[model samples]
Target: MKAYAVLVPGLAASAPADADVRAFTETYEYSTQPEGTTSVQLWHTARRVTWDEDYAEEFEHRIEIKHGVSEHWDVATSTVLVQSGRNGLTLDRVVLGPRYRFADRAEWPVDVTLALEAGKVADRSIYPLELRVVAARDIDSLTLAANGIVGVQVGADVIDEVDLAIGWAAGASYQLHNKLRIGAETWGGTADEGPRPPTDGVNASVGPVVHVAPSSKLWVTGTAGFGLTDNADVVAV
Candidate 1:
């Protein structure tokens, strides 16, 4: 008879991960657009975790806001709440991060970004620092992108190493119309701990993604992931 606290992130599916790109595992999009740009997005994520041999469910609601400080700098903030079988409803985590894009920003076929994030959950705080690289090329009506991600975490009750995670994501999308696109993405991450291989405790998932833009300023995106590893949650939507 044991229990674990489920922690979820407060971020939109389109939240930027790097200079430019979006994947199921992470976003490689730039931190800032142009100097006077701002946007907000609301997202919902449902996750199911297996406890012992049984299943437990959790739901998260996230509200994220981003503001561009300059052409190469942008800041983002998010707040999230989770409802779980054991905790009922409670604050999950709050995250604030800044991103810096190098070279030609999002238009570069290969772009790089440095991001720093701090999160607070309960009485514990964690900071994650990451370097993300994105390479994308357009082939006719289709776009293909690949991302390489590496990050480290430090804080109380968390890992304090320099290389805590190594992950990658690949995406292919077809533009069906002026306002719509459909794609599939796969992402995987491995934790660096103990003597196991880099992917020993890996959490891997893959699913389809859709993006819709009804107007210039409004966008809607959704994706679902099915776990491919025993360590991963069964399903996420």
Candidate 2:
């Protein structure tokens, strides 16, 4: 039996809403589940302030569903079905994509994955593609893992906002046990909206993550992150 873990941390920022007003601003990471398995995730995020001089608190509730297409392939979808505070409680966009893992070949020390995502953002549609590399080395009683991601945003909405937008996410983790692991992850990106790459400045967060496997059919994860830069949310717990 095999299991899939959501070890990748999400990129936090603002997402465009209806009327091209940039109404709601925020974000995350999408990882695939294990083969022959179905997973449902409930994730939440909270913010008190931002870099735009807006002093408002925001909270978001996201629901994600993942199904393994094969041993090395997965299809997943996530939706911000509920939200509150600054963004208000409303249905947000839904993103669906497939992720493929290059685990059969051992030529490279790092495991690689390519993913493509597209869906609705408010009333607009978007297509974002990413490539992820996972590097891991196991030591006595502990396992260390490193991950890096790079991608671009494409769609009618994105074209209206910038010529080309790129984003990246990187993080590392330590496995304390087969069912529990702890780590710190930082993710940020840039687009054509500003001077160049990392245009709006980089937003970073440090935090602890926990994963529990209560049974072969279920796995649970919880994470809390504190903002490390002015561009990030004050606290996401």
Candidate 3:
């Protein structure tokens, strides 16, 4: 489940027409909120995992607030809560992300954005840092987007060395109406183990996405993801 609330109604009103249409739930788009506008988003996800004879369900909730600093830059902060199996929900992490776009849409073949994120996990000494390159293009009413991501852990606990992880997400969506859109998305990631070829294991999923913007201040996006590898959850929503 997801929701979007714009705080500065006047600024949002003057934004571009497509600014409020989010094509993919898991894919990052190239557009940022209008300058001086703030938007709040809430997200919830649940996944089913099975291993041998054991099965478990995991749930996560996140709330994020994003503010546009300029036409090219936006910053966001989020808090995560998670529950696994029979355990009660607990605070998982806090994250801060800042994104910047290179130029106006259609100025180049594809719009490009750079995103940097940092997070502190609960009870973990290490802090995680992630960098992503987001690229997107609009072809008439259809939109295509992709993201390349790299992440590493830092802090006193990782003073010796750090391993890198690589991931990617891509999606394509077409607007069906002023308030509805549909898309498909796929994402996968691999972690590097010490001295090993980065192929230790992989987690991947692919699924269909639906986005509904009932109004300028409220929007919902949902996806039903199926695992593509042994390491991924059996099903996710």
Candidate 4:
């Protein structure tokens, strides 16, 4: 028997601050990384195609923030949480205000996000303002997901619309040891245009997730993958 190197990214999903992005062409769907720090990650996969090993690779770096603590309330009568703060949910950052959790939890867990486009990184490209409305449901062995986003470029009239970024990924994980698990997972996403659609693009990934929980509050993860099609990137920049 032979042992192989397995990737381990611990229980980061439990409290990842900015973990929902399935609702647009620009946001990422799911990541096992936690909030309040930055991480650079790379992944690759090799497949035996035509008796030869073909390979694909991807890499990405992300900065995440879990800014505030939210209080949840229950309102069974009207089915809405009484506003405890000023934030409300909308795709345009249409409004930048506090949001209150309904007294009772909605059928799904919800998070509202607003990307302030107050500055530009470059002179040629104007970073657009994006608003995200995301909801997710997780069960014992399966997870459910859906999201919607509205993107607006400051000066570009060509980009503005109510777009739903929707997709799902599922797999049952098995622990092979006290600190390692092996399993296959996959997800797909597309930008469905509303009246004004964002730039058209497709994002999806399929491979394995190495799950580990090292201590009470620390875990690390790595994902390696190969694109099923040549159209996918050798390195997703």
Candidate 5:
């Protein structure tokens, strides 16, 4: 059978509830997410902490590896399978958090997201019909959209407040004078209002995505940001 999908990496993938969604596209597509891009990310997060921040530097040499699939990463109909691992050094064990992703452009033609909100363990790795609306234009030099997320975990124990959260993000992508493109995104949200509260903090980050190829099967992108939440958001790699 012809390969409808290629194996890209949802490698930059976060947690279903806490992972940052903006940086996910490049990891999933393993290239550039163009107009007709469709992909999936396999991600996870793990962590251990101590009340005494003094021991924060105690952890060392943590490693992990995971795998999943993607659509439209290398090709539109191509299903890209992905596997990734991670390592870290902190006061405790593997860092934990949820994952997040904005829907593919073709689905909304503007901006949209489907996400879950939990930090420790994932409620479900598959898309669960959780979506956020986006408002933008069709084909413009710059694409801007505003979206938010709200979700709960059913299979696990519920404390009502632990699952409910408020989060929103604004993202934009622009094409420069040449093939070089510029893109940026900002996102933040709050989680854990439960009794045994996982972690009550705000999660926010902003970064730029560079598209060297602009329009090509192969491309490169890198990102950096800070996340403040008690969620388990693990990138496959």
Candidate 6:
């Protein structure tokens, strides 16, 4: 589940305009808030896993605050809370990131954005760094987007070498009404101590998604994802 709330008015003060069209729950689009505007987003995710004869559940809650510094640049920070099995909910990590768009919509064949983020996890010496290339294209009422992601784990604790991960996310959505859009998305990734084949230690999922904007100030999005590999969770929402 995902919810977006606009706290400040900018170029437009209406639904679908006030907030970017969030077509996929896991994939991000190439749109930024107008300069001087601010927005808040809340996200919740649940996963179920089975190991031997035991079943465990995990929950994650995230809150993000974003501010636009210019037409093409924006910065955001996120706090994550996590709960696993019978453990109590606790702070897990905090991440800070900045995103910059290369050109305005329709200025090029596809709009592109560069995003970089750093995160610190609780009680862990290893820190996480991520870089993503976001690309999207709009054709009438239909939109297509994709993201290429790379991540690294660095810290004093790493013995031999740092860990590396790579992934990709893609989605397509079509506006059915002024306040509603329907879409589908797929994402997968693999990680190890260094570069390796994509089939190694890989997990993947595919899902259908929906976005609804009931009012000018609020927007909601949801997705039902199913695992495609044995290493992935059975289902996620």
Best by lDDT: 3
Give candidate 2 misplaced runs (Cα > 4 Å).
1-32, 50-54, 86-88, 105-108, 125-141, 159-163, 191-199
Give the candidate order by descending lDDT.
3, 6, 1, 2, 5, 4
Residue ranges of candidate 5 with Cα displaced over 4 Å: 1-129, 158-162, 177-179, 192-201, 227-237
Candidate 6 per-residue C-alpha lDDT over 1-237 given as tens digits, one digit per residue, 9 for 90 to 100 = 455555555534432363454667888898976677777778888876433336667788999888778888989899999997789999998999999999988899999999999999888887889999999998999989999999998987655378788988899998999889999999878852112233467777889989888876667888887877765666778
lDDT per model, in order? Answer: 0.62, 0.51, 0.80, 0.33, 0.36, 0.79
Model 1, span 89-204: residue lDDT tens = 77778888777777663376655666666667656656655556756666776767677877677776674444378887777778898678788887777853222244458877
lDDT (C-alpha) at residue 195 in model 3: 26
RMSD of each: 7.5, 10.3, 3.4, 13.9, 11.0, 3.7
TM-score, cand. 6: 0.89
Q: So what's the TM-score on candidate 5?
A: 0.44
What TM-score, computed on C-alpha atoms, does each candidate reach?
0.75, 0.68, 0.89, 0.41, 0.44, 0.89
Residues 170-235, model 3: lDDT tens digits: 999988997899889998788531122335688788999998888767788888888787766667
The alpha-carbon deviation from the true structure for residue 190 of candidate 5, after best TM-score superposition, in angstroms, is 1.3
| Clash statistics: count for each candidate | 7, 6, 0, 19, 45, 0
Kindly provide the TM-score of model 4 when superposed on the true structure, using C-alpha atoms. 0.41
Superior by lDDT: candidate 4 or candidate 6: 6
Name the runs in model 4 displaced over 4 angstroms.
Answer: 1-59, 72-120, 129-135, 141-183, 187-203, 235-237
For model 2, residues 1-237, the per-residue Cα lDDT tens digits are 012233222210121110010001122222335456555656676655453444455666777676667767878788865454546588767878787766643445654556666656676556655555545433554434444556565677775543343455444455566655555555444432221244456666656555565543445555566667666555666
Name the lDDT value of residue 64 in candidate 1. Answer: 70
Tell me the lDDT of candidate 5: 0.36
